[model samples]
Target: MRNVVLGVANTVAAIGFVLFASIVWSAALPLAIGLFLGSLLGPRIVRRAPQTALRRGIALAGLGLAVYLAVEAYG
Candidate 1:
């Protein structure tokens, strides 16, 4: 399924980010803590939300980012 693939990809990306932070960033501790908290709390928060609202918000955000990128590209 698409969600499964995306979830796997996101996990890999998160691992890569943590590895990079550990190797290069002195703020890795805080970064790791924030990531840990997000991982712990994010699913619980999202699970209770309305799916339609979340989808709409994501679409709006993507559209806004696209418009911003277009303007930035043209300017």
Candidate 2:
């Protein structure tokens, strides 16, 4: 299944990221703090948002990122 393949890919990517992070010791603390804060506050924020609003927000974010990348690549 596509989900199984994606899950395996994500797991492998996560392991690779951990290995890369271990080599970049200085980033560990900041990444840890960010992970902690996101874990703590992310769900709470999402829970309060309406589903439609959340969907639009995600779409807008993706669109913005695509535009930024396009500009960076070609402008």
Report the C-alpha lDDT of model 2 over 1-75, residue by residue, as the tens digit. Answer: 999999899999989987775566687789989989998999999999999999999999999999999999999
Residue 32, model 1: Cα distance from true site in angstroms? 5.5
Give candidate 1 misplaced runs (Cα > 4 Å): 1-34
- Error of model 1, residue 63, in angstroms: 0.7
Model 1 lDDT, residue 3, Cα = 94
Cα RMSD of all models vs. native, in order, equals 5.5, 4.5
Q: Which window of 10 residues has the lowest lDDT sum in candidate 2? A: 19-28
- Strongest candidate by TM-score: 2
For residues 7-71, write the lDDT of model 1, one tens digit per residue: 99999998997777556566768888998999999899789989999889889999999999999
